[model samples]
Target: MRLVVCLKAVPASTEVAMDPVTHTIVRDGGDAVWNPYDTAALEVALRLKDEARAAGQEGWVGVVSMGIPATASLLEDALSRGADEALLLSDRAFAGSDTIATCYALTLGIGRLCAEPDLILCGKMAVDGDTAQIGPMLAAALRLPVVTGATTVERHGAAVDVEQVFDGARRRLCMHGPGVVTVDKDAATLRMPSIEGVLAARRTSVPVATAADLGADLDRCGLAGSPTQVVSCFVPERASDAVAIEGTPAEQAATLAYLMGEVLA
Candidate 1:
C-alpha cells in the first residue's frame, strides 16, 4: 500500500499582513510552520505506515506540497515524522494560485509521484485560507472518492473505514482504496521527531518538481487559472462600547438569566 499526504506551510502567527495590490496574505516574509490540521493528517498517515510495517506489508509513505522553494524545509519535518519520501512542487509559475488552481497543480504533482496512490490524506482546512476546498477539489480532479472531517481511519481489507464528526455527531463510513480524506484536529497528534529521524531526514534528498515537470499548462496554473478574484480587503470598523451590569454575584446571575431569556425567547 502507498499513501500520499498533502501538506501546506502556513503562517505560524495569527498576525497576518495582506498585500495592498493583490489583497493576498504576505507569505514570503512570515515565520511559518506546517498547518496545524495538516499535522494531524500527517500523524494519521504515519500511524497507518507503522501498522503496515508491523503487518509485514510493503508500504510507502510520501509527503507532497506545493509552495515556494524556501518552504522545502517542511519536507524534512514531514520526513522526520515518518514519510518515506518527499516531493516539493515549486516554481515561479505556480505563484498566486487560488484553491482551484492549487488543486489542479497538486493533482498533476500527485500523478507524478505514483500512477495511483492507495490513499491521500489532507487537513480539513488550511489556516491561511480557511476555505476547506482544496481537498475535495483534488479528489474531484483525480476522480477519487473523498471523506471529509475525518477524526479516525482504519484499514479494512481493500476498504478504509472512517469516523467523522458532522453536525456535532459522529458518523462512520467505509470506502474503497484510492481515496482521499480531509482530517480534523481530533484525528491524531503528531509524534515528535527523534534525533535519529532528524538526522535521517537531513541526509535524504528531496526532489523538486516544477510546473513544466508536472506537464501543467500555463493557462491552467497560478493566477491565470484562478477563477475567483479578490476585489478588496479591509478591517471592519469598531462597534459601540459595551454595556456593564453592576450587582452581587447572585444578582448578576439573575440579570444574565433574564437577558438570555429575553433574547432567546
Candidate 2:
C-alpha cells in the first residue's frame, strides 16, 4: 500500500505582515516551517505506515509538496520522521497560485506519483492562507471521496474509519481506500526526529518535478489559471485606549460574567 501526505510550508511567525498591494502575506525573506496541522497529518501517516509494517505488509509513505525549489527542505523533515520518499513540485510557472490553481497543480503532481494511491493525507488548513480550501478542492478535482477535519483514523482491510470533528462535534465516517483526508490539529502530536533519522534524511535524494515534467496544462497551472485577484490590503485600525478592568476577586468575577453574557448575547 502507498500513502501520500501533502504538506505546505508556511511562515513560522504568528505576526505576519501583509503586502500593501497584493492583500496577501509578505512571505519573502521569512523563516518557514511545516504547517502545524500538516505535522499532525504526518504523524498519523507515519503511525499508519508503522502499523502496516508491523502487520507484515509492505507499506510506503511518500511526502508530496508543491512550492518553490527552496521549499524542498520541508520534505526533509517528513523524511526524517518516517516517509519513504519525497516528491517536490516546483516551477516558475507555478508561481502566484490561488487555491484553485494550487489544486490543479497538486492534482497533476499526484497523478505523476503513481497510478493510484491507497490514501492521501493533508492538513485541515494552511496557516499562510487559512482558507482550508485546497484539500477538498483537490479531492473534487481528482473525483475522490474526502473526509475533512479528521481527528483519528484506522484502516481495516481496504476501508478506512475516520473520526471527524465539525462544529465541536465528532462524527464517525467509513470510506474505502484511495480516498483523501484533511486532518485537524487534534489528530496527533508530531514525533521528533532521532539522530539516525536526520542522517538518513540528509542522505536521501528528493526528486524535483516541474510543470514540464508533470505535463501540466499551461492555461491551468499558475497565476494565469487563478480566477480570484486581490484588490488591496491594509491594517485594521487599532483601538486607541485598551482598558483593563481590575478589582477584588468578587468584582472581577462579576465583571467577567457581565462581559461573557454581553458577548454571548
Candidate 3:
C-alpha cells in the first residue's frame, strides 16, 4: 500500500493579524505548527502502513506540503512521526495561493512525488483557513473519488470502508481507491516519535521542489490564479455591559417584564 498524506503549516498563535493592503493574514511574526486535523490524517496513514507491512505487503507513507521554505521543518516533524519520506512544494510563485491555486499546485506536486499512489489522505480542514476545501478540490484535480470528514477508515485490497458523522447523524461508506480521504479528528490519535525516529528525521533532509521542478503552470499556481478576493478582514468590535435587578422573585419578574415592554415600545 502506497499512501500519501497532505500536511500543512499553520500559524501557532490565535492572535493573527491581517495585511491592511493585501487583506491577507500576516504569518511572519509567530511560529507555525502542523494543522491539528492533519495530525489525525497522518496517524491514520501510519496505522494503515503498519497494517500493510505486517501483512507481508509493501507499505510506504509519504507526506507532502505546499508552503514557504521555512515549512520544511513541518515535514521533518512528520518524518519523526513515522512517515517514510517528505516532499515540500515551495516557491515564490506559490505565495498567496487561494484554495483553488493551492490544490492545483498540490495536484502537480503529488503527481511528481508518486506516479500511481494507492490512496491520498488530508485533514478535513486546516485551522488557519477552515475552508475544508483542499481534499475534495485536489481529488477533483486528480480525477479521483473523494470522501470528506472520515472519522474511521479500514482498507481491504483496493477498497476502503469509511465512517463519518454529519449533522448529528452517522454514515458508513465503501469506496475504491486510488482515491482521496479527508480525515476527521475523531479518526485516531497521533503517536509520539521514538528516539530512533527523531534521530532519523534530524538526519533526513526533506526534498524541496519549486514550480519549475513540478512543471507547474506559473499562471495557475498563486495569487494570479486565485479567484477569491478578500475585500477586508478585521475583528469585529465588542461591547460588554451588565445590569442586575435585585429584588424578590415576583419583583424581579415584574421589573424584567417592564424593561422588556419599555424596550419593545
Candidate 4:
C-alpha cells in the first residue's frame, strides 16, 4: 500500500506579514515550521505504514508539499521522521493561490508520485489559512471519497475505520481505500527522529517539481486560477477590559484581598 501525506510549512512566528497588494502572507525567506495538525496526519500515516509492513505487505509512505524552494527543508524533516520519499512543488507560477487553486496544483503533484496512492492524508486545517477546505477539495479533484476531522484511523479489511468528534459526539465510519482522510491534531502524536534517521534524512535529496513539469495550465494555477480573492488582511484590533491596582506589592495584595472579600460578600 502506498500512503501519501500532504504537508504544509507555516510561518514560525505569530506575527506574519502579508503582501498589501495580493493580501497573501509572505512565505519566502522566513523560518518555517510544520503545521502541527499535519504533523499528526503524518504520524497516522507512519503508523499505518508500520502495520502494513508487519502484515507482510508492500508499504510506502511519501510526503508532498507546495511552497517556495525553502520548503524543501520541511520535506527533509519528514524524511527524518520515517517517510520514504518527499516531493516539493515550488514555482513562481504557483504564487497567490487560493484554496481551490492550491488544491488544483497539489492534485497534479500527487499524480507524479511513483505509484497511485492508496490513501491520502492531510490536516483538517492549516493554521495560516484555517479554511479547512484542502482535504475535501483535493479528494474531489482526485475522484476519491474523503473523511474529515478524523481523530483515529485504522485499517479494517479492504476498508479503513475513521473515528471523529462530530456534533458533540464521537462517530466511527468505515470508508474504502483510495480515499482521503483529514486528520485532527489529536489523531496521533508525532514521534521523535532517531539518530540514524536524522543522518539519513540529511543526505536525502528532495525532488522539486514546477508547474511546467506537472503540465499544469498557466490558467489553472496561482492567482490566475484562484477564483476567490482576499479583500483585506489585517490583525483585528483587540479591546482590553481590566482594572490596574497601582501600589507597592503589599498595597496591591491588600487591595486584591479586599476585592475578593467584596465579591464573596
> TM-score for all predictions?
0.90, 0.87, 0.91, 0.90
Candidate 1 per-residue lDDT over residues 1-265, each given as its tens digit = 7899999999888887877766667778358899988999999988888888889997788889988887788898888878888899998788778998899889888888877889999999998788999889988888899999999999876788999988999999998869999999778999999888899999987899998898899898888888875667666899796657779999988988998898799
How high a TM-score does candidate 1 get? 0.90
Candidate 2 structure quality by residue, lDDT tens digits, 62-160: 888888776777798788888888899988787777898889888878878756889889999987777899889988888899999998989888789
Best by lDDT: 4
lDDT of 3 by residue, 81-182 (tens): 899999999888987788999999988888888889999999999998899999999888889999999999899787999898878899998988699999
Per-residue accuracy of model 4 over 152-207 as CA lDDT, tens digit each: 99997678999999899999999986999999998899999988889999999999
List candidate 4 stretches off by more than 4 Å. 242-265
Q: What is the Cα-based TM-score of model 2?
A: 0.87
As a TM-score, model 4 comes out at 0.90
> What overall lDDT goes with each candidate model?
0.87, 0.85, 0.89, 0.92
| Residue 121, model 1, lDDT | 93
lDDT at position 6, candidate 1: 92
TM-score of 3: 0.91
Worst 10 residues of 1 by lDDT: 21-30
Stretches of candidate 1 exceeding 4 Å from the true structure: 235-240, 246-265
Show how many residue pairs clash in every candidate, following the order shown: 0, 0, 0, 0
